[model samples]
Target: MTGVQKLENSKRNKIQAYDLAIHDWYQFILGYPPHLVRHYIEKFGVSKYDIVFDPFCGTGTTPVEALKNGISSYGLEANPIATFASKVKTYTDYDPDLLLEYLAYIRRSMESSYSNYGIVEPQADLFSYKARFCTIKVKDIINLTESQLQVIPKGFISPKPLLKVLIIKEIIRSIENKDARDFFLLALAKFIVKEAGNVRFGPEVGRTKPKSDIESIHSFTTIAEIMINDVQKTKLTGQAQIMQGDARSLDKYMTRELVRGINCVITSPPYPNEKDYTRSTRLESVLLDFIRNKRELRGIKENLLRSNSRNVFVSDNDSRYISSFSSITSIAQEVENRRLALNKTSGFERHYNKIILHYFGGLYRHLKTLRPYLARNCKLAYVVGDQMSFFRVLIPTAELLGEIAESLGYRIKEIELWRTRAATATKMQINENVLILEKK
Candidate 1:
């Protein structure tokens, strides 16, 4: 009934998008809702003097939105695949001249090799996809030689990452036959795994697709066809600066000049007992050489919220929570406490008890630390959803965050519940709530 409640209610409404897909360079992997990004900026009254930050900058959605409105922005994320996609989306200050020239050269190169690339289809079924996408296409990726690839030109100042980009780019661009709608491009750009032997696009809902399906079409040809079409048609517009780095230690990657005092923080840490980002993005890491093997990818603690994964360091604060839980119960509590203490540093196995304590404790530290860096009257927001861990209700996200933010001297203005799109199953469901905080 009050003004505050009314405002929160309106913010909870599902967004309505406008405009048709027009841009070609706009691609996204794990893209955020554009209107939601716009909504935050508009409501917060962000200015040029303010800098925006997303500590868990998955795909750089927040940073890109900030930049589009002429606000300088910075993002921090650890996942290599996510980092790459964010970089592409946020680097709006690109050399359009370079882009245009590259596009021309790519077209010519693909045009020249049409016949050679398009040979007998190893499987007739995929030919439909290829034919549907291209007038001239490569039916078999295994047949191509190093000589054929030599013309593409590598060396983009990156070591292995450049080659990965080129391959994905060439594949997508050479096969696009559509009029280049934004949605289609986005779908393709996010389809890097389409060619991998283990890749699957996953279900449109909570991301559950059979592993066999991913293995079915995962060859060089099908992957390239999907990507090439997606890239060629995607249209991206706006300003952004999506740098790849760690939020926990931004000072390490950012020089003295680049790191800015952030005005707002909005992120969703991985669920406490759910999958890890590094493991989830395993396909990308291996294909791109970011990680050597599955073992290498495990426990890559860059910026995944301390709250979500069991793989967090056990701090003295964590001990206090475990001690509290243990005082109330015995067996499960003891097991959880031991697991938490075992991984005293960070990056541990997924523990039910420790994850609860870890989530709250980590978020508290994140907010408490941000106190000195945020601008005056700046707003902070977090998207979170709580689950019943051990039949004990845990809505510690908002309450704990509010307490910590207050301790750090920020005002806990509101906790807005925004109904988000989630899947049927509890594991993969997307439950997003917006917790708004402000600096005095």
Candidate 2:
């Protein structure tokens, strides 16, 4: 089947089996699939000489895909854990044999540690049945700081599973090699979310019934082996540079050589919705030490586009950037009117209207700030979804983004239909589109 036909028939968001190498190692719950990146690369006629940039490079989907196709890429991300994941996923220099040796050492360490503590090794069948059969006491395990404990949402990870995670985490950190240590940590992060933690994602991060004990070591080893296989098969022909920083002012992270060096762009920035985006990774972020305290967490949120009420602050002035756009202001006003009519007086309810303005305003600054770094006629694709999250008010994200890009001297190439998803609030199908643009 043709590429267009395949995209039309296939589920656009799912990671296909063929594209599951480094991408499956770590990913955002809502990130676009690697095939979508390939589609844009081919559509834009990208080559090894070109550099693909993803400003909101959540978990390095764009960069990893670009590197796999022998194309150089650059990425910028605000979330620390996501940045770490991106760096680890795109790194191709790790020795798989060394990785195996490290895995062996980690296994030995875990086994010895458990044996010394008189704790029986958790059986594979126990994890398979999702049973709470283990007799491990939470008080006996190593604990995180009160600050760290406070950051993780309550019940997101039960005490027993958290203890197992902390135990494996200490073992992984003891690896002398930084690269191997990071690789093992990434595997553990996956294990924390998918295997050990009570967190589940049905498009939103929430808690499930807690598991008393999990086969933490066995599960982590399996995850590490999968990563090792991907690393072993990797044949990198191009380089990737990933930076952890706000996308609104990405120039700060750009080196002199990268000025106007970007040839194409493909990314999915955070949509304007109620989803915090941070909560989805809170379990691993806190356990892995990416976010250690409330202050550090707030700092990370400050760097992101203020798309939700949780991240919006009183001092924010991003909304002022697009104040002249009547279309945007009108929508914000409508949202406020709807909130008032509904008698919604909560603090977060008050920020609902402001999120609309600040969200687009942040994107406007992002586009304007990114102008000088784009090569002449550089093609770009922003995979954005429409939202009815705030009082069921429709926010045409791709269309507004297209207008903002045009205002910043980018030519709108097309607003292609990527897919459609059901709005969580209204349960109505909303269009998720790719706003294509070219540098003027």
Candidate 3:
């Protein structure tokens, strides 16, 4: 491939090695890469004086990149765990010495906890035969409440790993410094999903072979040291503020000083599909106390863009915003028609049509809510993909989103193709495009 072609391919979704300092602390599996954000930041001539914003800031990829480039940015995320991560990753005022001190304290506390359970100093690999034979009383293990247990998918974590994680979590909580505690917690979150938890992401949250036990302390400290080193080497140039709120009503979270202040926007909102965005972070969310019960889970979903069958609620009226747009309504109708034709009668299958309408409608609401806050001629890039997840019906997400933005008085600049992926059901390639827009 030519150099330009190779560059485009690399920028599609892969995070470059040099960009891992803060971006890799914790991230969503489907989040757009930092290079993609840099592409738009440069394309729009975003500078230190300009403010960048990401409404659907999953794990702060845009905000973290913006800060790295010395551009002040703001991000709004509906998921609490993502909001927490964005705040932690973009924060630059941490003391490495203090972090190390906290780490030592945490290690000592963990070692003591292990000894109480009859595990000795220099804890062996929990998965080892002798280690596996080591036993702890059931009452000593930290257990989730029935409601918390119900929220996480069955088999997402085994008992031993969960016990070790909870032990570390308790030790981390005893630290007095909030930032230090959060820094440690973020590292633990990574260890949970990547090491301790039985979850795997093939782009969809699913189970892997269960890990009988894990060397939790070692794994957590290793992740923590990497994060601490990144903080030590990187200079925090730009400012970032991440808030947990629905994107559709951004005005609720905006400050008076930021009114009409945003010069550029870059983000990847959830696409209309069967994949529940919450499931990807369910283990962390519940484990971290961001979500505790069915009620709390519903509350988080209600604040997000209705992009999947799982979050489409009867009380939702986002579809009413696009009542006159036949192009979008037709797609929703077709999905429903396909569902009926195929005799798909499950509860989730029944909501396929609504997911399309609600998804686009939610974006429309977001763009409309964001207009008054954007500076004149502000450029926006939404990284979204086409999907055929529902009964083999295609949803041109970027195209339809552009149409919605236009009706809300934004000008459609261009729809740039980022990459294409095979549809899960049909295995046919589908485009993931960056829908560029400008405030008129």
Candidate 4:
């Protein structure tokens, strides 16, 4: 298909009935659809016996899709909550019937316990509860550490739902089976994000509405049931391994045994936008003890690919990797020039140019790390988008990354347009394309 045709096809087939299996568990609002991953997997000629790798596997779309197709795959994600979600979503060893039975036991125990505490069961239609703040007094509910409480924004989760969630968390933790505990916690995480929290993703994480008291028990049970049903339907023979580590340094996670086996890579790395990837999972991450303090939050941000100005620090030297690439340098300079012309003097505005440099540099470092792992004929596909976030200075991200890959001894096979999104700042259409490459 032509590039435009391919883009149209991708948009048309973004979601299908078949995609609702394992991918619907916990997904980002702007996560690329399962069909896109499958398209690249098929295009790369990856077979069941071959191994595929996703260096920036956000929510395990690529790896889960790979396993569904009977192909073994490996994934790397920097965010702990995302990593946990990816690992749990792809895990198929949980017996669906046993999971349901466990859910029943937990529900009964929780209900009985809450009854003794004089807490009524959440009504089925309790989703419409719009109390200003949870007036229901909760006593002896599991409490977050002062540090953990500080991580969550004020009013993110109100008293009643928070109490219920804490109770569920405590109950889930007491489960002896590691898999069952993870499954239950994962379900709870989904509940927190989808129902309990007032957070919304307008393609960015923010609070759009007020939610005082959520139907916590009802929502959790409903989600757990859906997960149980999904687990029963998903039958797979291939393995999906997810590593919670930075993609910039694959050596820390990619083992020698996995290196020589990987023949294809399909991933969508972060683009040079001021989007804090960590914030998207902050609610679950902090609640689940992934990040409890400013120090821990900063530490997690440090491990991610530097795509935004928010995470840029004085110690970051990824820009050195692209010093010799005039294409990247030119973009950085252009962004700075635009900033100067626009008279933008904010600290973040000043670092827009630097963020562009660091973003590509991080990707370059990551690609360089992959060189030692990929086979001679390994095919790779990077789903990236153009950016005009920096004072309307357009960033040709896919083209520039393709050039960088070529410089790193990879041959550019094609740059196929996958889709387009309107830049919120520029009101211009930004191309989201797949940069196809092959190791020489």
Which residue window of length 10 is worst by lDDT in model 2? 125-134
Cα lDDT of model 4 by residue, 1-440, tens digit: 52224546436436667688778888876577887777877677788879889988988888988988888889999888888989998886988877876786667656655665567775633323322212222454557888888878766777777777777777677677789889888888889998888788876778856776666666788899988888887876688889999988888898766966688999999888889888888888888888989889999999988888889998999999999999889989998998888898999988898898899999999988888898778999998889887878788998999988988899999998787778988677778899999998
User: What TM-score does model 1 achieve against the real structure?
Assistant: 0.63
Q: After superposition, how far is residue 284 of candidate 3 from its true place, in Å?
A: 1.2
lDDT of 3 by residue, 1-440 (tens): 32223576536577878889989999899898788888888888999999999999989999999988999899999999999999999887999998887877776666667766765434444332211112234455556899999999999999878887887787777778999989999998999999989999996889999988777667777899999999998887878888889999987899875795799999899888778899999998999888999999999999999988889898999999998999999988998999889999999999989988888888889999999999999999998999999898888888898988888899999998888888999999999999999999
Give lDDT per model, in order. 0.48, 0.87, 0.86, 0.82
From the highest TM-score down, the ranking of the candidates is: 2, 3, 4, 1
After superposition, candidate 2 runs with Cα above 4 Å error: 1-5, 8-10, 124-142
lDDT score for residue 386 of model 4? 92
**Local accuracy of candidate 2 as per-residue lDDT tens digits, 1-440:** 43643765347778888889899998889898888999899999999999999999999999999999999899999999999999999887899888888877777666655655565765522233221122223454457889988988999887667766777777777678998989889999999889998988986788899888777667787889998998888776688999999988976888875795799989999998889999999989999989989999999999999988899998999999999998899999999999999999999999999999999999999999898999998999999999999999898999888888889899998999888888897789899999999999
Candidate scoring better on lDDT of 1 and 3: 3
Which of 1 and 2 is ahead in lDDT?
Answer: 2
Best-matching candidate per TM-score: 2
Model 1 lDDT per residue over 1-440, tens place: 33223434334432223311111123223334545665677678777767777777776667766665677677777776666656655544334443334334333343333434442223324322222222323342222234333322222113222233333344445544322222222333444344322333232212222232222123433433434443444444444455555454454555333434666665655544344445445444444445554344444563455544435555424424333333223433654555566654443434555656655555555665556666677787776654433323334345555665676688888877655444434344444567788888
**Clashes by residue pair, model 4:** none
Better of 2 and 3 by lDDT: 2
